[model samples]
Target: MRFSHTGPAPARRDDWQTLKTLWPYVWAFRGRVTLAFACLLVAKLANVSTPIYLKDLIDGLGMPSTQLTVPLAALAGYGLARLMTGVFGELRDALFARVTQGSIQQVASRVFRHLLALSLRFHMGRRTGGLTRDIERGTKGIGFLLNFTVFNVLPTLLEIAMVTGVLLWRYDWIFAALTLATIAAYVLFTLKVTERRMVYRRTMNTLDSQANGKAIDALLNYETVKYFGNETYESRRYDHDMRGWVDSAVRNQVSLNLLNMGQGLIITIGMTALLWQSARGVVLGRMTVGDVVLVSAYLTQLYAPLNFLGFVYREIKHALADMERMFDLLGHHQEVADRPGATVLQADQASLSFDAVDFGYQADRQILHQVSFSVPAGGSLAVVGSSGAGKSTLSRLLFRFYDPTAGAVRINGRDIRDYTQDSVRAHIGIVPQDTVLFNDTIGYNIAYGRPGATQDEVIEAARAAHIHDFVASLPQGYDTPVGERGLKLSGGEKQRVAIARALLKSPPILVFDEATSALDTRTERAIQDQLDRIAQGRTTLIIAHRLSTIVHADHILVLEGGRVVEQGTHDALLARDGRYARMWELQQSRTAETP
Candidate 1:
């Protein structure tokens, strides 16, 4: 049921380590980043320099009759400087856009590719919805981090330093000292509170992912839920997770409010003290009205970015959290990987053999115990067994989905492990028992057998499987969309589509793993006739539970408890009166009992 991921999983890493891992992506766009840094510097300088102009203009306008009045040109220059500050800042963002976008694109693409390269086990264990959410949130976080870290955080610090130096130069050292102390306290408080709130944020994110995962899982299995009439049960389960999310989300909001209020209180107190000191100096005749105004102007400029700093800081932390989980998924190690220097499967003769293979899905539970079998080029072999007798494991071994704990599977006299997995798979065609189609048009699903196949070729394949007339009877024909997992199609129809797909693939080695299990007796017999015609002089491996399907196989294997208890031609095996004989009798009895 699982698709193959051909590459090894990257080493597992912590979440925050993703930031470090992301440097290469960022560095890839280094030229633009450097230009953005220059713009940032120009913008900061323009911003701070404009406040000084305002200070000079205030002082000039407020001069006594004995002093010269502020020039109209001076006022115009001040306005121009303010406008230039915004222009430079915007230019910085524009220049940096590519770096941000390219970095996000690189990371997202790598993660997506890694998912495809991961082992079936890792993917089967993950929830599609949750994994997708992590990727979504992570990419968004990259944008936030890039913008805020490059623009907001850096600018705020630069502006604060400028304000302090100006205060010390124009006013008393006391003003600069108090300003530094107040900012340090504010920053410390914000950092501590934001750090504490991280726990709540983390919890809310986890709950949200869980809720999304549950909702998607339920929706994908919508038919099953309705079949069991468990709509209310599903609703209750979803609501239960939602309630927990609501609680966590509410707490997260409350903590944010508390942090915001605390930050506001500190800033308010600092502004009051700063303005009060300037007023005291003016009243004592040590400073003028213009000086007080200038001091206030500088403080306001300093506070603007400082306030923005709080928001930028919180956003960056949240982004880091999202990136962490996403990167962890990217770091997953593939349990199944190709050996070094492996070459493409030659498949010259298309013969297959299980050389004393011992295998298991889990180490403690062996599925095949030193089972060995082979089919010569252009021969047919049918394996029949009870449900737990490991009939399907043979096909998986030949495909190299998993390695045997002991021995190996060989194709054309070369160990399957010695060839590239993709090439090995490319040479084999399978009509699986449970054929799950994509939510797409009928033609699209059919064409998936051989990508880029011509329309005529698709129709011919469908005709070969005896499903073309049924499809043509529909209004949309091949264009009709199959519902999720082809739920709109009948079981027999799905099997036919699968058969057509394998036929289209035209691989040298073919596996029919319960290919007709879903069909009624009439359809089975009809398809079996076509299958028998097509299977001639081609290496074919049949894994079937229904003995009737394999009655005339060139060679038959009756496996019991992972060991082949009997093997021979149908007539020859029946003549022996062994396990194969008993199974054949049981299937015939079941067929006779069916009304």
Candidate 2:
């Protein structure tokens, strides 16, 4: 299995151009979308006919005193038509939502897979909580946009056009022009206010992210906060972020209220003019009393959908902003890719070599400068260096976590990057300094190294790491759950469990990174013996802070300021009286003080 670190999730964009790119995710489900559009057409036709039915009923009622029976029956039929239309419209909305949700699933799954393919460098620059929020917003945005755009907004616009046309044909140019101008004004005003509201919404999202970041920071460093008694400080900071969010929310609500008020004003003005025109036509014998009633009724019905369209329009815009952020994550280029016709490694030979390599995390600051070293096939080499001296960078390059900037790292005399990354790294095992164990059973954690490993193999590896006795002593033995990061275990116990995991991998090359740094003298000695035994007849690279850990290695390389300053056995390094000699002298003095 391959594990990848996720990068920073995309942030929301204000541009509508971003929304155009997201249309492809929905296009993948074009068949369902076509069905939704068909349903929308049927639903909208009913919506437009509803007002006409009411007009006919009003005309029938005012026709004459002797035709009461026909008008009553017509009223009943119109009511039934309205009822059926509502039912059909609701059913159509249900179908549309189902289709929309499926499209959302496809987009979200693709984004998640893409995020997992990103390189470790991307993750190092981001925070976990921000990424989580981005994904949540993205998925929700897709669902919102699909439902509103397909079922509500499109149908409403069609209804507006039909209503405008009817007024022009039935009444006169005055009524049609008044209705159209008022609607145009309503839409233009709503758009103007919405643009302002979106700014507030963006502010709210930013503050919300800050609050989540603060919470995550506190939770992950719970121990540090408790040690420093900084609970009040953290609480105050959280409150400050939340307050900013509230301020933005208040601004957004005010803008929305303004939109609603503006809509009500426009509706009133349009309806008053419509009523005045219908009354004037009746008095002049150009229309009847029933025509005035019919015109008044249809005008309000038309206004209802138009008024709602404003709100839905704002929501859709916000949703699009969210979706743009999400697709941004999916668009990130993969940091590493397999070469054309790359093949898996087939050789059993185990060797690692770095030939005049130069590397850096950034362009101007080199982490390792012109470094050259080689570990024999099935032999051990220990790399010793101070902090920031490129010891860990060497290990990362060896595992192909990163490729060297200026030279090649070869495994079995093959360039590591030339092969498929999975195949290249599969034969190497690492025991990381930070022991990260999932909240799972001890057996599962041990077997993580080789997913297909049997129960006996897991137990055997645990025994070799000197952790079997501790595991067996637990109430549930191998079945006992390890808490998050194995926090339930002692420091030395967690280290041993990590070692057992690396051993179970059974890779041809083994790596140990200051494995016993957290252990006591006796525990270190016990595990050190097991590590030495495991290193035999295998290519091993040990990075050790404690000089005693790698004292007996076949060869020791001392690094300083990204360059190799010393190379030899322990005895030879002590005789040089340089950086390595000073480090040995400090260890000797510390040992003598241990009375």
The numbered model that scores best in lDDT is 1
lDDT of 1 at 280: 98
Task: Evaluate candidate 1 by giving its C-alpha RMSD to the native, one decimal.
Answer: 4.3
For each candidate, how many residue pairs have backbone atoms clashing (under 3 Å)?
Answer: 2, 0
Residue-wise C-alpha lDDT for candidate 2, range 557-580, written one tens digit per residue: 999999999999999998888899
lDDT tens readout by residue for model 1, 1-595: 3232212212333545767888899999989989888988888887877866776687787767887775677688788888889998998999999999999999999999889878766777898887899899999999999888898898889888987888888889989988998899899999999988777667767767777887899899998999999898778767766787788788888988998999999989889899999999999998887788778888788887788788888888888877887887867976778889999876545988888889888879999988888899889999998999999988877877678899889888889888988999999999999999999988998899999999999999999899999999999999999999999999999999999999999888889999999998898999999988888877999999787888777788888899988899999998999888888888889889999
Clashing pairs in 2: none
Candidate 1, residue 493: CA error in Å? Answer: 1.6
lDDT of model 1 at position 584: 83
What's the C-alpha lDDT at position 142 in model 1? 94
Q: What local lDDT score does residue 367 receive in model 2, on the 0 to 100 scale?
A: 93
